[model samples]
Target chain A: MKEKLYRAGDIFSRSVGLILFFILWEAAPRLGWVRSTYLAPPSRVFGALWLLALRGELARHALISLRRVMLGLLVSVAVGVVLGLFIGYFRRIDRILDLLFQAFRQMSAFALFPVFILLFGLGELSKTIIIFWASLWPVLLNTSSGVKNVDPVLIRSAKSMGASKAFIFINIIIPAAAPEIFTGIRLGGSYCVMAVVAAEMIGASSGLGYLVLYSEETFNVPEMYGGIVGLAILGIGLNWILHRAEKYFTSWKEV
Target chain B: MAKIQARGVNREFQIRNTLGRKERLKVLEGFDLDINEGEFLSLLGPSGCGKSTFLSILAGLDKYDGGDILVDGRQLQERSFSRGIVFQSYALLPWRTVIKNLEVGLEIRHIPKHERRRTARQYLELVGLAAFENQYPHQLSGGMKQRIAIARVLAYQPDLLLMDEPFAALDAQTRENLQIELLRIWETDKKTIVFVTHSIDEAILMSDRVAFMSARPGHIKEIIEIDLPRPRTEDIRNSAEFAKIRKNLWGMLQDEVLKVQSYGGYL
Candidate 1:
């Protein structure tokens, strides 16, 4: 079998491809290949972002959006991990909840906005709920699976050494599941940002998402593009930090 | 004296049918064996012959229904720290460094941190892998990983090491080299090693005795004691005596292999 042409997360350095993409992005609007009205020039979008930052609008909106994302992430991770570990460790509980949870997990979390708004009301609670709901499943599901699929041989090996069940759970099971658990948390972090932004765009009075939607409604194309660029930056920044955390925590695992 | 004994051990697997009926798959039926202390014994057989199942039962990692297994004349009921296992897949925790892995048993024993490190260092040097102490399992090749696995089992200070095809995944050259390393280690420690392997040459080269087994309600066919001289090296592979034993095992093992072929048709 032929090997894959490229590996995921191996695109960080020596990137001829990403450079070409940026160059094309800059050239398209300037060359009139793409209309500036439909697709604002990168320079203008950046300038707009810079002006907003200078005027403090970007900082205010970005901070508001970031706060929501962090709160949602914190809540979801705490609850989701506890729930996931319970579901994963208890076979009976896993069997009962896996099907129902998977069904809810199957439905797009954003589609629950109406239900969230109805239950929690159109406030910060509802916005946070959207993100919390979006981020919960990945952590919960990944953790459960991670716990369930730990190599039986490893467990057996540990058991043969006379390791207690509690010792095995802490040392063997947690370390074994760390890689997958981090994967869930990282995905949840991304979902938190995405869900919050979407929620803000729909109803929040202020935030990066609202800025983008408000700019678009007011026909401020550069500001709209700048807000989106802000989102991309936020997403990239969150991923990069999570990458560092994964490195620190899973130093024992293969790169 | 017998170091380990299994008297009419039986293990069965219950499988659920489509009609919700349970069927019993007898893996080992009335199997019996005796292993002496400080001797290298190889459980030689084809795949799924319950050799590993028996080894696991002996190691107290699995339960058997119909027999009494005595370890050092004590009835075996649960995993004892005195018995260690080395798996074919190496089974080293990928998250742990070589030294950390070697220290696992000591950790379970609740040995002081400094003491465990000193012991881990000794065993790491014993396996000639001291330079790779900080390396994780993923960083090591199959041969290196298996060496680390041996080092860990040694560090655990188990008198009886249950090795399940410890070198089966390595290349032939690495396998041969590890076999030599194992002999050298065994010479120094003289721990009783129960090795499981499907390879006839591996069995003859490493064992003081080979207990051949047959599948489909697996049981030991016969125990053949290898009368080959000690500190046996690869040069023995060229000798007439080595050839004779290999031929003997191959001839007996061929029938079992053929049984597997008529039923399963693959190695």
Candidate 2:
């Protein structure tokens, strides 16, 4: 009963903090302490959001952003896992590709945007490629590191039990490296969304980033605020969803 | 036929310092030993004694510069599906639940999924972890993780079991409990076991014969037989007979242990 009360008290305090934050935000605008032109009030942003929702523009933009993020992330995951397994398991391959991987990873995805644009044009291809590039390194590096860090004792144990190389890879290496790989996937997902937004902002016809830029240029301050709010919500939502998935996958792990 | 025989086993490791000075570290030097089928032998020595190196050679995970290991009348070059090892770390796959971890060896052998599940369940029950089959290794205590490891090896039905200080990482209480559990498993499995440990008490408790080794190019110094009765309980540690044998083994190891420490090595 004491434990129950403590937990309830903890949760209640957190809820109070959230309520206080909103109260402060609401007061700042009501008192006109901040310029309304530069920082549109949260109330005004919500009103613009409601208008976008009624016109269905919000859904359309969110769907476009979601599709791009998923496509780029899926490709990154596939290529990263395969390449990582190869580099992680084989000493020769790891040695051969180590420098190349390191150099490529050091180069930022944003810096390579121009190169991608030249290759794939300013269509969805270039935008998707930027996301793919940003997402790939984390997934690949994490997977390889995970595979490399598998316990030598486990390898010895598997060999003693007469498991073949293929068997050990499937049975031991993959499962042992799973937690790290999932961590890589989460990092990659975040990068994928961030990169897609940047790609859309730089050169794209439709996306939340493009919508934000278009509203800012047209001097639709409320619409711009609405776009920024939407992007923030999307990023938080994606992160939360992936975190839930990670939690589900690693449920067997002790907290 | 002898369960295992190592004739003139020599293992060498090459090391290069930062100055590019290359040197040879001979871990095992012309080591030789033999074990009968169904024997429980403990290789007892201090750390850096190469007892584990020797065991690794016997398990066919490491290649010797010379000599060969024969298991059941067949000379082997590398590990086959005939031996199973329990490492000191327990080495349970953290991502898998206890049952899934136990099923790894079976899964590797391409046993049907349902059969693997049944076999894993049986071994999990044997280890007294049937209720916690779905629990991950991180959720378990040290002793429980080691038990899952033992079950995983047993699931493979290997004729020869190689244990490299399997309980050395646990606390004293947990170690003693695991030693008792190990003996029980050995009795039920009826497979030949070659266990490596530094504890004289542990060597005497679990083995049919204790092979004491001297460190620094490790060599077997003596083999003492334990004529104690089966199904050993914790009370054995307090028994007169057990004390007598423990003293005898400790006497033989005293000089070696001193020799090991004087040479700047650990137990």
Candidate 3:
């Protein structure tokens, strides 16, 4: 009985806002304060969500959306890490390319969707490329800065003790820059999800973004709300997972 | 033969002036010193007097525009394991545990894992930090962190130990405690130590000889040998001889301190 009460209290404290929001959502439409057609009631949205799951369509869309983000993010992570290492470690490369990278970063990734579609041919390729483009800067920017900002005193101390360049890079530079890199990765992770939604809306036949668009067009306000809810849930879940990864990797950090 | 020798060593840094114009600021000039093996020598000076800069050049971390520095008859070029430094800020890798931090130089040199662990453990004990092995740098106090820095450098077993105001960040009590501990370890290790500091008392208490440095474009003005008895303890600070030496050094530093004020303000 004590354990049950403790669990109840725990759940209540964590979900108080969520519970209240859902309560308000249910009451508003039902009491005719808000039109159900424009903003579906909580029960209707949940019911539409249940129907999507029952038909396995939600699972398929979530998987497809997640897969696109994963592919794009993987490419970004690989490219960002390699390019970041080069840009950070090689003074000449950084000096030459810093301006160019900064100038190109001024252009929004979505602004180049038409360009990507033309170059890659509008299928999964263009969508993934757009997501990759959207997310690359955070990782690249964070990583290079992380590498650059490693305490010069630490490097000097290491060097004074005859630490080799290769040895220092592996043992010092990489680990020192990790916290910043992980932060970039988390930021990039969020960017990936947001970018996939935009890319999916522009050209995709499937995915959660398309589902939301289709539901809106068909006047299925409940399903549209369900799609929005799914995106929110996906974003939260991704953030939580990435946060756990960051904690595990940066276990030594005081923060 | 001197373990380390600097003859008319000069350094000039190209820095932007207040006018946003590039100017050559001479940080070190006509600097001469002879450091004997296994002796604790402190460079006592005013702030921005280039004592740390001189130490850096000796450690091969910075380039000297002119003049000569020889370590065991060989000229300095780049960093080597023969010289290890303990920075004012401790410079511990926050990502590594206390024991692992000590293993940095050992790991870099490709020492076997078992031996590295043993060496780190031994130095950890030397610094009286064996209990805190698993803890990260941020977990430790300022004094504790500096102790770890000392242990880390000692673990590497450099022949020349260069220190830049290693205890400056610590409180009075902690600084005194580390100073005593440092001497005890120095007795055992017997590395040629070139310690740079602004504190007159710290220079007297910890060093076998204190080299008083002049104002910016710094060079040794005088080297005072402390004939105080060995195994210096807390009681030595109260000794008449210690007070005399302190007074003498303070008089030397006072002029340099005034010079620093004339330029702008003291560090």
RMSD of each candidate relative to the true structure: 4.7, 3.0, 1.9
Model 2 misplaced stretches (Cα beyond 4 Å): A1-32, B16-20, B229-241, B262-267
Give the C-alpha miss distance for residue B61 in model 2, angstroms. Answer: 1.9
What's the distance in Å from true for residue B227, model 3? 0.3
Candidate topping TM-score: 3
What does DockQ give for each predicted structure? 0.64, 0.62, 0.86
lDDT of 1 by residue, B1-267 (tens): 699898998998897756788988788898989999999999988787889989888788888989888888989969578989999998898888889999999999999999999999999998889999988888889999999988888887988899988899999999999999899999887899999999999999999999999866789999999999989898989889999999999888889878988875432
For candidate 2, the TM-score is 0.91
Report lDDT (CA) for all predictions. Answer: 0.89, 0.85, 0.90
Better of 1 and 3 by TM-score: 3
Which docking category, incorrect, acceptable, medium or high, applies to candidate 2? medium
Model 3 TM-score (2 dp)? 0.96
Question: How would you encode candidate 3's per-residue C-alpha lDDT over A1-255 as one tens digit per residue?
Answer: 999999999999999999999999999999999987899997999999999999999999988888998899899999998899779988788899888888766778889999999999879999989989887888897899889999998888888888888878987889999999999889999999998988889878999999999999999999999999998888888888989999999999986
Write one digit per residue (lDDT tens) for candidate 2, span A93-204.
8888888998988889999999998999888888889999999999999999889998887787777777788888987888778888889989998898788778889877
**Candidate number of the best lDDT:** 3
Q: Distance (Å) between predicted and true CA of B233, model 3?
A: 0.7
Better of 1 and 3 by lDDT: 3
Q: At residue A24, give the lDDT of candidate 2.
A: 77
